[model samples]
Target: MLPTEKDAGSASMSQVSTSTERANQADVAYGRLKQLILDGTLPAGAQMLEQEAATRLEMSRTPVREAMVRLRQEGMVEIRPRHGMRVLPISASDMAEIYAVLTALEGTAAELVAQRGITPRQLAQLRGAVADMQTALERSDLKAWAAADEQFHLHLVRLSGNSRLIQMVGQLWDQAHRARMLTLQLRPTPSNSVKEHADLVDAIAAGDGPRARKVHEDHRRRAGTMLVDLLDRLGLNQL
Candidate 1:
């Protein structure tokens, strides 16, 4: 007997549902694994097989494999043909290079945001992030401060309305996550960073493009230099 049109449609719908489910699972696996790496749960130089990672993530090996491939593309992991994945470490030199790119791209983003003139609500969000950083620092909560700091920078970049710039900077953020967290405590309190961020918000709010760009670029440069120096002085070649 020939299949009815309704039956064929059902089959097609089933295939679509299955594909969506797989993609969702793959996304879950990717987020979980990426978080593990970023938070130092799966620290640099760690190695695991696909089966082992799947077991840990409580997902199927297929989704885990897909996640590993994504991570490899982001330079967070290395996948050997039969050896599974090895977490990649960022060296001090790598951080320097990453910071250089971030400095240029993010400065441009700030300038664009200033030139475009954000809405009051957008300006409030940036100020709120800065406020969060200030409050966090007062309580000696570097972790919270770091999170807020990231929020401000990422939000500022997105305000540029440049999708490609946002994407490129996001990848860099992921790649630099471990080192930043590692050095978070090793360096002095980020009092200066909070102040600089507040200043940047003011500049953006005033629509001073050159001032916004200069302020952010100098902040990034100082941060990059301090982090590199600390890493080198402490002999932390890879993190």
Candidate 2:
């Protein structure tokens, strides 16, 4: 029997709706699982089967499987044929490597922003982040300080107007998040770091590309060295 055009159209729409729903579900699963890992709820070296992940996420195996594939690609997890996924831990060596790449990428981002010139609104946003960091430190709230610090760097990268740089730096930041949070209290007070951020902001506002690059790169290199040294001294081979 030949189907009517209406019937074919309806069937096609239904297929499209179903596909969209599945993709949304996969995205939800991916975000939830990644957050769990980042917050240490899942913890490093944790392993679970496909069914377990589905059950925990309150979804079907299909979407959970799709999410696992993404995490695997991001170096956040490893999927075994039948073992589901294992959360990969970051070691001190991994920190060194991640930071090295971050230094170069973020330095270029700063230079670009300075060379191109930023708007007053954009400059205010960076200043606001620095102010927040200062307030957080004054209150002895390390967590809040960390959040503001992340925002400052995030704004720096975004101001570069380079999509690739933003994406790459974002991924590396996520990879280093757990380790940095874990070692926050162990590191020295961040007074100098805050000042450095302010200095970088000044360079950007003044359109001093070379100074901005040098300030940002030097800050990043020092931070990376300190973090790696802290991790090694504490014998945290795997974070």
Cα TM-score per model: 0.96, 0.97
Task: Locate the minimum summed-lDDT window of 10 residues in model 2.
Answer: 185-194
Reference-based TM-score, model 2: 0.97
Q: Name the weakest run of 10 consecutive residues (lDDT summed) in model 1.
A: 189-198
Overall lDDT per candidate, in order of appearance: 0.94, 0.95
User: What digit string (tens of lDDT, one per residue) describes model 2 on residues 118-184?
Assistant: 9999999999999999999999999999999999999999999999999999889989999999898
lDDT of 1 by residue, 63-169 (tens): 99999999999899999887899999999999999999999999999999999999999999999999999999999999999999899988999999999999999
Identify the runs in model 2 with alpha carbons over 4 angstroms from their true place.
none
Q: Between which residue pairs do clashes occur in model 2? A: none
lDDT of 2 at 30: 94
